[model samples]
Target chain A: MAASNIDPAIFEQLQAKIDEEGRIKDELKDIIQQLEKQGRVTQSILSRIHNTPTGQLGPAVFQPCERSILTQIHLVKVLSDIASKHPFYKWNNLWTREMQNLIFCLQLRHWLAHQELETIEQVGNELGVPINVKDRDIFHLTIEEYLLALTNTIDELTRLAPNAVTLGDFSRPLQISKFIKDIHAGFQLLNLKNDTLRRRSDGIKYAVKKVEDVVYDLSLRGLLPKQRSSDDTPAEAKGGAGAPASDMDSDVFLEG
Target chain B: MQMAGMKRSRDGPKPQGRADWDSPYIPMFENFRAELDEHHDRREKIIKASRDITASSKKIIFALQRVRNLGEKIPPPLIKSKEYSQHTSTIHERFVSVAPDLKGINAYRYQRQISPGIQEFMEAVLFRHYLETQSILSPSESAKLISENVLLTEDDYVLGLFDMTGELMRYAITQMATNGELPASRTGGRGNILTGLQDLRTKLEALDVSGSYGLSKNAEQKMSTTRTSVEKVENAVYSMTVRGKERPKGWNPGMDTSRPVGEVEG
Candidate 1:
């Protein structure tokens, strides 16, 4: 309104800011690639169990998993600084690819370490990044990015469902079903407007159905454990269970 | 949530040598790591290429600005010169070289990251073309030169055009301020930049951009920005004609036409 003036000082400040962002953005690319590498390494823990005897995975697998988790936590700290500082805005793209990659790492590690999905607030706390930093905090991943990562993790879990059955872990199918449903409910609570987010959120139902079908198939074959069916196991209860139940096969009733 | 059970397994005995669990996943892990490494390298190359495109495109915009003070008619030799072709071709070549990389990465996945460079390139090239030719560069025309056989989405084209309007507004204002008046139309009456701005506004306003998800809202916001830019140019032109009448002929508003003589010390 005031004669379209371009102040030289303000322009120089903007150039400096862009330069800083460029440096950080390049650094984030490297960090995201590392996070993905660590995620794949952590994922090997699940795959290793598939090749070995169901009850014989011993404590060795924990070594790599722990290393991967530690590296990811470090990366998430760096990612949080960038995300909370330079998040989506007028000059910048709001939803960042780097944040999505970081979210994937955070979710993958939590799922492997705790066997449970991590809530956004829980993740924020773990990374020392606060979600309630008012508007445009670039250091924190937005709820939408978290939901996208959750959808990707569900896809990863769906891939693992068959391996669980092969390992004679029928209870895992039920656990996955419950886990995915809880995540689906979390997504339903958010008011999504981005077309991609809406479409991906719609996909949660399919994942829920896929996991349910696995449970249904196991149940129809009478492979399910004789647990208290009248009472539903809360998701957090099973997720927090220490160690894979090596005696899970004993719980299954085999029919001749 | 058995805390004791968790602790026990976490601190369990280490496996001895020749443990076979790692064998099954070792190759798979190596393959995944290799793929990630390749992707990282490819992205770095793309970023470099996009930066090259931005720098060259800015030079092209600077070249276009060189013609502003010359006159309404851009020299025919300059329009067809090797220099112009080289700048435009550099963009085409850069994009073409990165076509495979962009395909593998999926452009939309990194759209927000790479979009500033792409949009800036668009603004520069499109502004240059508009200067040479009085018409706005259509999406297809821009795509042909810069998209490198890979079609840029309509949304990206529209977004690029949104910024181009700002460039046009600035060019018009600078021309009027430094040259004493806007460039005359072909019939030698109204300014050509004014007509170009009006035409661009009308064309952008008539489009049905509602079908694009997430873009419609952005389109509304950009429309307001484009409107403001147009008004600024119009205001500058208004002041030049109505307010500069009292000044002598050939008096540029921004330049020092009549410097005050310093007093000589005896």
Candidate 2:
């Protein structure tokens, strides 16, 4: 078969899409920076509250007013951009979907950074379970069991994104779903080691006496088998044993 | 009898080269041939199944390619600002018209005269400023502070509170943009900025600056005093104008109420 031809128009369109996506990505970095600055402002507010006289204010006074301000500011900015960029209702749905996805990413990143493997696994399992098989036998049964457990969990989580406005298209990639499941399985395997009995056993002390005895026996006997069949017969007689005795005698007499 | 005799003459002698029917090897040879036929049948079935799978996969790939082609033909949604700049311009004009007179209006007096919506916007701005500078209190400690100092109900205050926060985020973005950091948040949703701000606040709370610095009491006192002064500046910017007959109806002390503070004046 001949190779297919590429369409220039399609290529150009795809290139344009990529360029736009790149611009957005660059813009996102700036947005993150803005968020960081807003966060600093909130932190300053929080510090002030922390330093305030205890008797003067209630415990709820430190609920991060500045942080809330920053959050509101971020929201308004986003809204303004959306209002400017999108038609009234159309942008709302897109924004909601984007926000939900962003929040999920943030949560996932948080769990990953803290080494919270169990939580990560739980989230992944709740989304979908991926199965990975290895050559080792000891891990076989447990891995299979965890995979089954994860499958059940993911079935439940798959239902969650569909209903959420913000989580639109989250389940578009089957590969990603499977990857998440596999991550869960990996986390479960990591946790499984904590309960393994092989880790607890000290085989060295238990087998020491038997090992010494085997060593002593080996030293005395030098690893030889019992006597050989050749020891029973003279070397010359053995050669003639395969032939008839009379024939052998005649040959011998002739030779003499 | 003559016809039968003729038939026997023609068929009487079997061909010398032909294999005997009674030979034992004939049955074994037949069995082997039958087995070979069965093996060929199985092989054919496997090939057919593999071909079917390949064809199905090819069909799927073709369908995907078609979808991709169609997607390329579709244009991206038009950006809202670019498409509807006129609407924003109108809103901007409105804000400019009202801003000058806003300074002369006292919070209480303005609340009585202007539409409830406009007054609400102003109050929200003040509260947002208070929150941004931590002039009021910590979010954690605010319920107690609210009980003592602030007289407004939670329901009445929430909108203004969120508005103020949104304003502050806008200010932050503007400052950053002025510094050539990045463009402001386009959505103006408030929620996204709030979440980001909260996350930052949490990180700051975890810092062990006190343990690292290890300052004496006098030095600590001095530092506290300096912090307090900076906080007061933030508070002054955030507070609402005091109303009096002699002082214009909305005399905002921070800056000229007629001019938008952050805009680059030509």
Candidate 3:
């Protein structure tokens, strides 16, 4: 037999590397699965907002939600410890979704309480992780991931505005409308490529409109707590959710 | 759950009120827009560089395909040819330009974007390595040859080796047709290009990449093509052996033997 040019050791080394990476992924996945469970718990608790009165939300929603979020944060720390030893992006896909979910939960909770967007730094500080890390390879939250969380918050808040009205909190829709519209406006300023962020950000306009509809419904019935100096003129219904990009500008709402 | 598989749908339209310009989140999102825009710009640069690298690597392989012998240095004249130099430079330039974008934490971030170019470059590198050394190039050596800035994954190394087998099949068939023999080591070694290929086929087949996530899908895809390439060489060699006495000199062995034999023989 002719001498083999391939060294058997080479394939062995590669197998070893593959096995090692699989082990790391398995470990991370174990923790991520735990994280996913906690995320669901948090979401289930937060989803109570649709029916629960806003005053009761502190004990019924935020408290339990925060506890679940903290548990998720602990799991993230465990994941971060194990993952930091390897290339960040190499195994990042394994946990990016979970991270996005966890951060979205944080953003949602913060918005429900504070009525403003959660800063990435605040998220990093709360989660005990770095945000937008660029200097060296280590575990950190990415801007895209946080932005994804913001988009999630926008979607959640849109749902909340309509529900808040149903719960007899008629003024809540105005705050939500302004918040989402502002968020949508912020998204418009971005030079987004065709990616998840772009797609999620694209939904922001719809969210802006959804909250506007709630506000408009309230104003039409004179349920608005206070009328604005300018006429309470609502822009056309986003007209259609599928309205192209150009259709968004005309969907604008004027403060009553 | 809200973020999972967030698809952009045309939900029913809501009202667009005049946008609140003085958004409290503007400064924060502006920072995001700047950072995201920079990231996208960097990604675009890397992607552009990657495509250029792929193109240059393919051209290099085209130049390398002209070589008539193996297990020795590529002819200096061919290596120094202007066309070859241009392609080599282009590959280097493309790789160097995107090198920073792929550094440290960002290495694996742009991995998907840059992988095709790396794989194509690996194919060219492996082909050249085999043409000169008559052996498979190891990942470390490949890493050294590529650039210090780029990380060469084992998947790229193995996939490139698989494609290099196709180049070998072509090389063997062309050589056997022209010279009536397989190119083997002239230094009293038992190894010939066909034996080396068969060895690679067996070696690669034996590699346990099933556990690997990225490699499992891509390696499985390449395995069948690799198997066919090795088989083509085997068939060429078999035809040459069995028909050695009857076939006219310089006749090409192809899938259709009857029609082109005389044309090739003359």
For residue A167, give model 3's deviation from the true position in Å. Answer: 1.9
TM-scores (chain A) of the candidates:
0.68, 0.27, 0.87
- Which scores higher on TM-score, 1 or 2? 1
Which has the better lDDT: candidate 2, or candidate 3?
Answer: 3
Q: Indicate the worst ten consecutive residues by lDDT in candidate 1 chain B.
A: B8-17
Q: RMSD for each model, in Å, please?
A: 18.8, 35.3, 7.5
Report lDDT (Cα) of residue B14, candidate 2: 18
Q: Write the per-residue lDDT of candidate 1 for residues B63-99, one digit (tens) a residue.
A: 6766753224567666677887687788778888877
Clash count in backbone of candidate 2: 60
Docking class of 1: incorrect
Error in Å for residue B138 of model 3: 1.3
Per-model fnat list: 0.00, 0.00, 0.61
- The clash numbers for all candidates, in the given order, read 10, 60, 11
Instruction: Please give the lDDT score for candidate 3.
Output: 0.78
Residue lDDT tens for model 1, A97-191: 54565566567556645557676677677666665232332455455566677787887776556666766556566666656655665555454
Better of 2 and 3 by TM-score: 3
Tens digits of per-residue lDDT for model 2, B1-266: 01222122121111112233122223333443454344345334433433433333233222222211110221223113343333323323443443332332111112222223332433333333233332322232333322122222222232233334334344333332233221113333222223333333332233222321112112234334434433433343333212222233233333435556444221
Every candidate's DockQ is 0.03, 0.01, 0.34
Candidate 1 local Cα displacement, residue B256, angstroms: 13
